[model samples]
Target: MIRVVVADDQALIRTGFITILDSQDDLEVVGEAGDGKSAVEVAQRLRPDVIVMDVRMPVMDGIEATRRLAGAGVPDPLKVLVVTTFNLDEYVYEALRAGAAGFLLKDASPQQLIAGVRTVARGESLLAPEVTRRLIGRYAARLRPADPAVTAESALTPRELEVLRLIAAGQSNAEIAATLVIGAETVKTYVSRILTKLNLRDRVQAVVYAYRTGLVSPND
Candidate 1:
């Protein structure tokens, strides 16, 4: 079973999410929290496979909670799936930067929510291509300027660089394979290598890294 913790300030919302997630055969709501601080506490103690976090809460807020649970330098970082009522660019950007494995609008359907949890639980990003382009592109200019010392060329081979670009562009392995005229397994290998070389956690971080390093741009 994929254990999950649902965190939200609203009791109704928390119960609703718990109900839906528990309904899934593969998912179980092991814990629930009403505020960001409690969410962090419960998650740290329980160490669920996935956390369904709310962006705005009374005590800390989901972004900070995510950072506490999954931020860089965290040993054995947990996978976080941020759920927010707002689709604002800043929230999405900050959540991803805080090491959330996925972001989903609260307005998303139950199936979408379930799928988001499963996607994060499986160690994959839940960002759809259009959503990624729209959210990350809008915030591209706000990202810190690329560090001159860390260039993609220095870390990745020519083909690996190409794969990273496609990944940042929000292409799936199958899509990338088709785009590069390569096999899916080859693309997967390239992705694994890119992550290892860059010391990135997953595709979401890779996208952030690509933008932070000026590798793949909003215009690209």
Candidate 2:
């Protein structure tokens, strides 16, 4: 079973998420928290497979909580799925940078929510293609130009470089396969190799890395 902790400041929202998650045979709501701090505490203690976090909560925000639990340099990072009513670009971008494995709008369908949790639990990121492009593109534009020598080209082969660029462009494995005229399995292998070579946690980080390294740009 995929253990989950639903964290939200509102009781109704928390119960609603718990109900939907518990309905799934493969998922279980092992814990729930009404605030960000409590969410962090319960998550650390329970070490659930996924935590459904709310962005805006008292005591501490979900972004900070995610950073604490799953951010960079942590000895052991937990998977976080951030759910927010606000679909604002800043919130989504910050959540991803804070180490959330997935970001879902609270208005997303129940099926989408369930799938988001499962995806994150399986160690994959759940970013919508359009959202990934818009949010990452918007934020990446503010970054300073990447160092001339620091790039994926040095570490990745030509094929891997192509795959990385497509990934940064928010293309799924199937999309990439079609675009590159390759098999889906081949695309998956390339993605896996890219992550391994780049030492990235998932596709989300790969997108960030690609942008940060100037492997791809917002215009691309």
Candidate 3:
């Protein structure tokens, strides 16, 4: 079963999520928290496979909670899915930077929300090109990248760079395989190598890297 913890300040929202998740035989609502602090505590105690965290809470917002949990490195690398009321790019970027596995809009359909949890639970990230570009405009506009152009010469092999570009473009493993004329497993391997080479937390961060490095730009 995919154990999950729902963290939201609102009791109704938390209960709704619990109901939806619990109905799925594959998912379980292991715990719930009213704030980020409690979120961290419940996550530690339950060691859930996925955590649905609300961005705005009374004490210790989701961002800090995610950061703290990441810093703790507890529960064998928890997968945090930031569920926010706002679609502000900054929130998404900050959540990803804080080691969250993915970003999900609060208004997303119940199926989408459940899918997001399942996606991250499988150790994969869910991010699209639009999401990546918007986050760049929101959080990366002021930041400076070490290099404007991160070429294959830097560290990534040509094949790996191709994979990174596709990832940045929001292509799935199957799509990437079709594009590169390789097996999906090969693309998965390339993705793993790319993350390791770039010292990134996940593909979502890799998309950020592409934007920051100008390998893929806001306009592109």
Off by over 4 Å in 1: 146-150
Evaluated at residue 148, the lDDT of candidate 1 is 46
What is candidate 1's lDDT per residue for 33-95, written digit by digit as tens? 999999999999999999999998998999999999999888999999998754455788889
For each candidate in the order shown, give its overall lDDT on alpha carbons: 0.88, 0.87, 0.80
Q: What alpha-carbon RMSD in Å does predicted model 1 have with respect to the real structure?
A: 1.6
For model 1, the local distance difference test gives: 0.88
What's model 1's TM-score?
A: 0.93
The sequence of per-residue lDDT tens digits that candidate 3 reaches over residues 56-79 is: 888799988998776335446788
Q: Where is the poorest 10-residue window by lDDT in model 2?
A: 142-151
- Give the least accurate 10-residue stretch of model 1, judged by summed lDDT: 84-93
TM-score of each: 0.93, 0.93, 0.84
Candidate 1 residue pairs that clash: none
